[model samples]
Target: MEPNATTNENLNLYEKAENYTKTSLELLKLKTVCSVADVVSTLTSKIAVGVVVAFFTLFLNIGISLWVGKELGEYYYGFFIMALFYLIVAIVIHKTHHKLIKTPIGNTIISSILKEKQN
Candidate 1:
């Protein structure tokens, strides 16, 4: 009877440990899903905004380029000026992209993933 009681106790302990492990794994999975969803949603919204802004800028530039060409008496002159301006801007961005773009974007993603839920 004593041996039987001890065996039953051990079995109960094992079952409790198994339950704990399964619960822990489920919690981990939930947290992972939450973090991924947060990151994806944040990125999706930003991309949408970026697309809208890009279209607006495209039309604005085209209008400005045409206007400038009209004023300059040659349509291509306005485009050339705009192209030169963009070339310079691109060169500057290329030089500082790591500092101005990459680090900030990386930090934003990391923060989104690590940010705790409010509720």
Candidate 2:
């Protein structure tokens, strides 16, 4: 009888451990899903806003280029000036991209993934 009781206790312990492991795995899966959803949603919204801003910038630049050309008495000259401006801007961005873009984006992604649930 004592041996049978010992065997039953061992079985119960095994079952409890199994259940604990399953629960932990489920919790991990849930947290992963939550994090991915949060990141994707945030990115989607930001991209939408970025698209709108990009369009605005495009039209604004076109208008400015036209006005500058009118003032300078040549459309192509205005475009050349704008192109030169952009070339300088591009060079500046290329020089500082790692500091201005890469590090901030990497940190944002890491922080988003590791951020705890607020509720």
Candidate 3:
């Protein structure tokens, strides 16, 4: 082939490769967004569960404290004990919430996003 013609063909091939790379990057971005959305959905579902459980816990705590006060004949100590118990329960729930956020569903979504990025 002529020198100019060969150079033009090389330029064309370079342009095509650049275009493919751009397209692939865009697709990866889209996949990452979709995976993030999936993770958010999972979090939302778990949050709903947490809310219900929290309300139940609240009622149970109140009822138990009231019962203990009546039985033990000491309202002040009953209240203090209830407060301590709730503090411990809150700490446990906080840790559990963190763990749940890193669960398989969340990890899978994150992994998919990373895989898309790598590709």
Clashing pairs in 3: none
lDDT by residue (tens digit), candidate 3, 74-93: 87667778999879988887
> How accurate locally, in lDDT, is each candidate?
0.92, 0.93, 0.82
List per-candidate RMSD values in Å. 1.7, 1.6, 4.3
Q: State which candidate has the highest lDDT.
A: 2
The ten-residue window of minimal lDDT in model 2 covers 110-119
Best to worst by lDDT, what's the order? 2, 1, 3
**Which portions of model 3 miss their true places by more than 4 Å?**
74-76, 87-119
Candidate 2 lDDT: 0.93
lDDT of 1 by residue, 1-119 (tens): 99999999999999999999999999889988999988889889999999999999999999999999999999999999999989999999999999999999999987777776443
Compute each candidate's TM-score over C-alphas.
0.93, 0.95, 0.67
- After TM-score superposition, the amount by which residue 107's alpha carbon in candidate 3 deviates from its true location, in angstroms, is 6.3
Q: For candidate 2, lDDT tens digit of each residue in 25-55?
A: 9998999999999999999999999999999
Error of 3 at 82 (Å): 1.5
Highest-TM-score candidate? 2
